[model samples]
Target chain A: MWSATDPRFGFWLPLALLCLATGFWLTDRKDSRKRLASVTLFASLALIVFFGANTRGGDTSETALLAVLLHMLGPVALMAIGSLIATFSGPTPVGPLPRGLRPLGFSMAIGGLIWIGLMLIEEPPDAIANGIGETIWGAWVEVFLSILILVATLAGAFCIMMGDERHKEAFTLTILTISAGLMFFEIMHNGSDGLEATGWYQIHWQQMVFLIGGLLGIILAFIAFIALVYMAERRAPDPDVVAPLTEEEKSVVDAVLRLNLELEEVEE
Target chain B: MSEKKDAWWGPIALLMLLIAFSMNLFVWQLSGGVEFSSIIDRMVTGFSLAFGITSFALLFVSLGAVHKHMRWQEQILGLFGCAYLGIKCYGWVGNGFDSISEDAVILLAGLTAMLAAVGLVFGLLLALVTGREHIPDLLLEMDSTDGDVAVELED
Candidate 1:
C-alpha cells in the first residue's frame, strides 16, 4: 500500500514522474522496453529513496509483502539499467538479439523474478545479505565490482588511445609501467587497505597513489588535447610544398589516368 | 570502431547522474547518513560505470543503436543482468558471507533452483501470452523514433 501523502512521497513522486517524463522524451516507439525499464527504474528509485530502506512504511506485518517487493524493486531497477547498458554497448540494436544470448536472457529475467520470490520468502531487514541464499547470490556485487574495475581501466585506455599511433600507446604503457615500478620504492606505495579506509584515515602510500593517478589523468587529457590540436592543424597539406605537379609529373598523372580508364572500360 | 547512431549512452548516463543527484537530495535529511547515502550512492555510481559495462557487453554481444533487431533475448539478458546484481547487493551488505550459516546457505541455493524452475514455467506462459498479435511491441522503446515502421496494404 503506497501512501501518496507520506511526506517523503511528496519528494519522490515528482522525481519519479520526472524520470518517466525524461525517459519518454529520450526514447521513441522502437525502444519501448528502454522506456519501460527507465520508468520502472525511476519508480523503483522513488520507492527506495522516499520510503528509505525500511519497506514496511510504519507497520511490520501489514507492509511485509510490500517490503519484500520493495526489496525486489532495487534489483529489477538495476537489471533494467544493466539491460540498457547491454543494449547500448552491444551490436547495433538489431531485429533480434544475438542467438546464444536469448537463452541466457530468459534465464536471467526469470531468475530475477525468482530472486524476487526468494526475497519475499523471509524478507530480511538488511538491504542485502541475510537472505535465504546470501552466499552465492550476495557475492554477485563484489564479482561485478571487480569485473567493473577491470573493464573501466581497459576500456578507458582504449577510449582514450583509439586512433593514436603505436608509439603513443607504447609511451603510455611505458609511463604506466614506470608508475608501477615506482610503487616498489615503498615510500611511493600506500599500505594497502580495503575501501573501508576513510580518505584522511589512509596512509601516505594511498595519497601518493591518488596523487599519481590524478596527475596521470590530467597528463592524459593534455596529451589528448595536444593530439587534437595537431590533428586539426595537420588536416591541410603543406602549402609551401609541391604545387599541383610539375609538367613532367603531370604527364605521369595523365598516363596513369589513361591506363586506369582503359582498365575500367575493359573490366566493364 | 563501431559507430553509434547518436551518443545514446550519454543521455542515459546523464539520467543516471540525475537519479544519483536526486538520491543524494532525498537523503539530505537523514539519521544514519553514511549508510543510507552509501546505499543510494552505490546504485548511482553505475552512471559513470555505464561506459565500462557497455564496452564490456559490446565486446561480446551486438545490439544495434536503433530498435532494429532488439528481441526477447536482449530483453532477458539485460533484465537478467539487473537481476543478477541482486546477488551483489547481498554480498556487499552486512558481514557478507561471514554472517551466514553454511547449512542455511544451502537451503537458499536450493530455493533458487526450485524457483528457477518456476521462473521457466512463468517465462513460457509469458511468451505464449505476449505472442498474440493484439499485443503491442513490448521491447524497451520510445513512442516514435527514426526506426518506426510504416505498413502498406494491397487491395
Candidate 2:
C-alpha cells in the first residue's frame, strides 16, 4: 500500500537500506559483495537526498531534512568531537596528544555542553515532520545526558579517591557533571515552550527504564557468551598424538639452534 | 593513614549525591501521581526487548564470525539460542506493535544503531591508540605452544 513518494517511506526505507549496506560493506569478505554494498549505500543516500529536495521550500519534508541534519551536526557531532579532543588533551592524555592542546580540548568540550543547553532551552527542533516526533528526540537527549552526567560523576569520584594528585582532573569532571545535572533539572521542572513538563517527565521515565533494561541486557548477554565459550572449550577433544622427531628433523632443529646461538654470541 | 582518611570523603560525597537524587525523584512521583504498576510494566517490557535483541545479535554475530572454528555441537546450540531469542524479541515487540507507528520504530532503531556504531568506532580507535604495544604480546600469548606431551610405553 505504500509508495516511494510517501514521506515516511522516503525517510525510513532508505535509512534502513543505508544501515544494511554499511553493515554488509564492513563485514563482507568478497570484493564483489563489497562492491554491491557500496552501490547500495550510494543509492540509498541518493534516494534520501532526492526525497528531501523533492519537496518545495518550507514544506514538511524539507523541514524534516533540515531538522535531521541539525540534530546530527548540532549536538551529536559536537559532543563526539569534543569528547575525542578532551580525552586526548586531558591532564593524563590517553594517546600521543600534545600537552599544549589541553586548553583547546577543554574549551571545545565546554562549547559542546553549551550548545546542548542552547538546544534544550532556546531552540528545540520540535517542528520535525514525517512522523519523527518530539518525544523520541527528547527521550534521546534525556538518556544521553543522563548517562554522561552519571559516568562523569563516577569517574570524578574515583579520581578523587585515588589520592594521586588528580584533583584538578576530578574538579573539571565535577564541573561538567554539575552543569549537565543542572540542565537536566531545568528541563525536568520547567520544560521549554516546545514541550510540556509532564511530557518531558514521562519521556524521562520511559528512557530511564529503557537504559536500565539495556544495561542489564548487556550484562546478561556477556555472561551467556562467556559461558558458551567456556563450555565449548571444556568439551574440546585432546590433541592427536604425534611421533617423536626423526633424525633429519633433529638435525634441522640443531642447525637452527646453533645458528641462533652463534647470532647471540656475535651480538654479545 | 591521612591520605586514606581524605579518600573517605570521596565516596561519602557520591553517596550524598545519590541520596539527593533519589529524594528528588520520590518527591516528584508523589506530586505527579504516576502509577507504580505502569512503571513496572514498562520496565518489564524494556527488559524483554533489550535482552532479546542483545542476545540474538551477540550469538548470531559470534556464530557467523567463528563458524569454521566452532564445533558442530556448538554451532547447533548457538543457532537454537539465536532462534529462541528472535522469537522472544518478536513476541515482546509485537505486543505493542500497534501502539508505535512503523515509521517511528524504524527511525528509532536506525538512530540507535548509528549511535552505537559510532560509539564502538570511537572506543576502538582509543583502544588501538592506547594499547598498541600490548597487541603483539597478546597475539604471541595466544599462539605460543606448551611443552611437548610425553607418552610412557608399557614394558
Candidate 3:
C-alpha cells in the first residue's frame, strides 16, 4: 500500500537509468549516437538530483530523503557551477587536443572524488527530528558546508555567463530551470498550510501537480538540448562539402562545424 | 575560439551562485523564523527566474537547431509545438501539486497522475535524447558521401 514513506519514482528510476545511460553513452562511437547517449546520461543525472533531494540524509529533523537531497545539492551545485566556470574562464587548454572534453572529464573526476570522500566520512543518515534535536553547533556545520557549496556553484555560473559566449545560453537555461523547480517546490510546500488556515485545504494534489510539472520541465529541457546537439552535428559536413557564397550561410556553417569539432574533441 | 570555449560554463556557474543565494536566503528565514509568506514569496520569485531562464535557453537551442534544419517558418512551428506541450504539462503538474488535500481519493489520484507524468517525461526525454540522431534522415543521406555522390550506380 502507498504511504508517505513510499519510495519515489524519482529515486529508483534515475539510478536504474544512470547505469543504462552511461553504458550506452560509453559504448556509442558515432557522433549522433554519442550525443543521444550523453543526453540520456545528463537527463538521468538531473532526475537523480531532483529525486535525491526528497530522500533523507544521515542527519535528523527532516525526512532522511529530504536531508539526503539537501546534502546532494551542495556537491552537485558546486561541481556543476565550477565546471561551467571552468568551461569559460579556466586556463586555456595547455596540453590537450580537444579542450572541451578535458573540462568535462575533469569535472566528472572531481565529482567522483567528492562522492568517495563523503562516503568515507561515514555520516549516518539523520531524520528531521534528529536534526532539530542536534546542538546548534552541529546544525551550523551543516549550514556552513551547504553555504560553501552553494556559493561556489553560483560563482561558477556567474563567471561563465559574464565571460563566455558559447555556453552562456546553456548556463542561463539550466540556472533558470533549477530556480523554477525550487520555487514550485517551496510554494506548494507552504501554500498548503495557508489554505488549511483558510479552511480550504487541498495539499496532496498540489504536491503531485507541482512535482509532475517540474518533471515535465526537466524532460522538455533535455529534449531541447538533444535537438541542439543533433542540429549542430548534422550541419557540420555541409561547409566541408559544399561551397557557399552568402556570408550568413558561411557563419551558420562555421558555427555548425565548430560544434562538430567540439564533439570530436572529447577524449573518451 | 578561446572565449567561446570558456563561455559554456557561465550558465553552470550562475546556477551554483543561485543555489548559494537561495540557500542563504532560506537560512536567513529559518534562523530568524520569518513569516511563511515572506519565504514563499522569495521561493516563488527564485523558481520563476530559474525556470524562466531555463525555458528561454531550451527555446533558443531548439530554435537554433530547427532553423538550421527546416525553414524559418517550420522552426517557428516547431517552437510553438514545444511551447504548447510545455504549458500543458505545467498545468497538469500544477494541478497535481495542488490536489493534495484531506480527500484520500484526490490525493491518491494526484499521486498516481504525478508519478505517471514524471515517469513518462523522464523516460521519453531519455529515449529521445539518446536516440535523437536516429530521428533525422540527414545521416542516412550522408552515408552516400562516404561512398561518394560521385559513385554513379550503374542501375
Top DockQ: which candidate number?
Answer: 2
Residue A222, candidate 3: C-alpha displacement in angstroms: 2.4
What TM-score, over all chains together, does every model reach? 0.24, 0.68, 0.22
Candidate 3 chain B: worst 10 consecutive residues by lDDT? Answer: B99-108
DockQ of each: 0.02, 0.12, 0.04
Candidate 2 residue-wise lDDT, B2-38, digit = tens: 8768767767677658944773484366348567776
Error of 3 at A145 (Å): 36
Candidate 2 lDDT, A1-268, residue by residue in tens: 8654565666656755665565456554753555667787788777767776665323443334445455746555555665566566544433657657645655655676687678776655445421444555565566556655666666666666666566666676677668867877777778765776777676656655655555565567667667777788889888899999999999999999999999999999
Over the true interface, candidate 1 deviates by an RMSD, in Å, of: 21.9
Tally clashes: model 2: 0
Identify the superior model by TM-score, candidate 1 or candidate 2.
Answer: 2
Worst 10 residues of 1 chain A by lDDT: A186-195
Q: Note the Cα lDDT for every prediction shown.
A: 0.36, 0.58, 0.40
Top candidate by TM-score? 2
Worst 10 residues of 2 chain B by lDDT: B126-135
Cα deviation of B60 in candidate 2 (Å)?
A: 4.6
- The better candidate by DockQ, 1 or 3, is 3
Q: Which docking band does candidate 3 fall into? A: incorrect
TM-score for candidate 3: 0.22
Which model, 2 or 3, shows the larger DockQ? 2
Model 2 vs. true fold: TM: 0.68
Query: Candidate 3 on A1-268: residue-level lDDT in tens?
Result: 5332333355434444554455455432643544666676688677655554544443222234335334444544544444443443333444323435534533542453255234323433444223322211122223223333443344434444555342533343344335334433343234222122111111212222233333344555556646745665665545455554699988999999999999889854
**A-chain TM-score, model 1:** 0.24
Q: Rank the candidates by TM-score, best first.
A: 2, 1, 3
